[model samples]
Target chain A: AQTIHQWPVAEIKAVGSPLSLGCTIKGKSSPNLYWYWQATGGTLQQLFYSITVGQVESVVQLNLSASRPKDDQFILSTEKLLLSHSGFYLCAWSLDRNYAEQFFGPGTRLTVL
Target chain B: SQWGEENLQALSIQEGEDVTMNCSYKTYTTVVHWYRQDSGRGPALIILIRSNEREKRSGRLRATLDTSSQSSSLSITAAQCEDTAVYFCATGYGNEKITFGAGTKLTIKP
Candidate 1:
């Protein structure tokens, strides 16, 4: 069984503050990892994706970045947060090379005040 | 931007009733996926309908794809309270990555 874990289910961060959200996967090795952002009342936006360590593809740049330090560890971070940066962040993994079916994490809710 | 900008906005239905949501894509895709997102949660894969198949079923849900029209439809029968969620349609043209639509908010008036 594969499972996804995300840290800090909810957070309140001040604008211009640094942010880091972590995601870890279990029961899988070398899977495709993705980070998506779903703004309030908006659609899910793919921010970044990585097929291997030390390499990530930016789908839609929004001043945030992601890194896959290890096979099961992925981190989403930003040097400074913006008010518009606040939203629900999700981490997903897929065994399918084309990502037909992606398993998602619980997600982290961030509120920038 | 890859999906319909002002299409398939939302849908409303009653319990025990049937409803279908449609999606149209701009690019050629070999696979189409449907995801359900509950409030304050991440989206989950509900079904993956491929281009080679016309329809697929899971429990009480059924999905139909029309490649010629570049569209798809998801149908839910005997819907329950748990069915009230946002439904998103995503496409995988030929690569591992996918692009998602704005999603249709399905409100089941129970």
Candidate 2:
């Protein structure tokens, strides 16, 4: 069975600080990866998606960027954090991008102050 | 925006009761996915209904998709306290990206 792992289960950062979050998927090769963010009592918004290594697509511009450096690794980072960047960030993967069901990893809770 | 203006908000029910949540989309979609998100956890797909199928069932959960109305509904039978969570409807328009609606918070009272 495939398993997904996310690093830094939770983080609290001040405004203007830098931030980085990571996700890794094991047991599955060449899977589609996605990043989603949800604010407190808000909808889950798609941030970015990658179909292959070294390429990523932006779904919504939240001043964040994502990179799939390895087949099983995805990273989300920002140089300067804003107060509005606080939310729960989720990492998801699907077998393919053809409307397949997505599996999620234990998310990272971010608090910006 | 694909989501309707009115948010599905919240629903409360007693144990063993049945509840249904509805969603409406703006554009055409080939698949509708239902997901459940527990507090502090990422949303997990619970059901997926295709456009060709009007309704699909799994255990105590049922999902209905209506292409004509551009809407979908998910129903849970004999609800339990563990069922308390936020339910979201996601639509994929034959693309790599899927859009999620503002979820409906369901609270099951024991």
Candidate 3:
């Protein structure tokens, strides 16, 4: 069975601080990875997606960037965190992008102080 | 822009009652996915209905997709307290990306 793991289960950061979140997938090869952000009671927003290593596409611009450095690793980073950046960050993977069901990780809860 | 938006913002029902949540999309899509998100957790896929299929059932949950109307609906029969959560409808336009709805908060009273 495939499993997805996200690092730093929760984080509390101040505005203007650097932030980095990581996600790793096991038991699956060459899967599509996606980054999603959701506010406390808002809709889920797609931030970035990567089809292969070193190639990431931006779905929404929120001053965040993602990189798939390895086949099973994806990282989301920002130099300066903003108050609006606080939310739940989710990592998902799918076998294919076309109508395929995505599996989500446990996710990371971020709070900007 | 948000692709899929649920008609009802929230719902409250008693246990064993049947509830239905509706979603309407703006663009054409080949598939519609239903997901349930518990508090402080990631959303999980509960059902997926394709354009060619009108209705699909999984245990006590039923999902219906109407291509002509550009809408979808998820129905839960004999709801339980555990069914209390936020339900979202997601639509995929080809291979571009899957967009999610705002979700409907369902509270089941025991």
Candidate DockQ scores, in order: 0.69, 0.78, 0.69
Off by over 4 Å in 3: B2-8
Q: lDDT by residue for model 1 over B1-110, one digit each (tens)? A: 66777544778888899989888898888888999998888899999999999999999999999999999999999988889999999986545567888889999888
TM-score of the first chain alone, every candidate: 0.97, 0.98, 0.98
Model 2 Cα lDDT, one tens digit per residue, A1-99: 999999989999999999999999999999999999989988888899899999999988998999999999999999999999999999999987587
Per-residue lDDT tens digits for candidate 3, residues A1-113, read 99999999999999999999999999999999999999988878888888899999998899999999999999999999999999999999998658688899999999999
- Return the top candidate by DockQ: 2
Predicted candidate 2 versus true structure: per-residue lDDT over B1-110, tens digit per residue = 77788665999999999999999999999999999999988889999999999999999999999999999999999999999999999987545888999899999999
Regions more than 4 Å wrong, model 2: none
1 or 2: which has the higher TM-score? 2
lDDT of 3 by residue, B1-110 (tens): 54633443889999999999999899888899999999999999999999989999999999999889888999999999999999999987645577999899999999
Q: Which sequence of candidate numbers ranks them by TM-score, best first?
A: 2, 3, 1
Give the TM-score of each candidate. 0.95, 0.97, 0.96
Worst 10 residues of 1 chain B by lDDT: B1-10
Colliding pairs, model 2: none
How far residue B63's Cα lies from its native spot in candidate 3, in Å, is 0.6
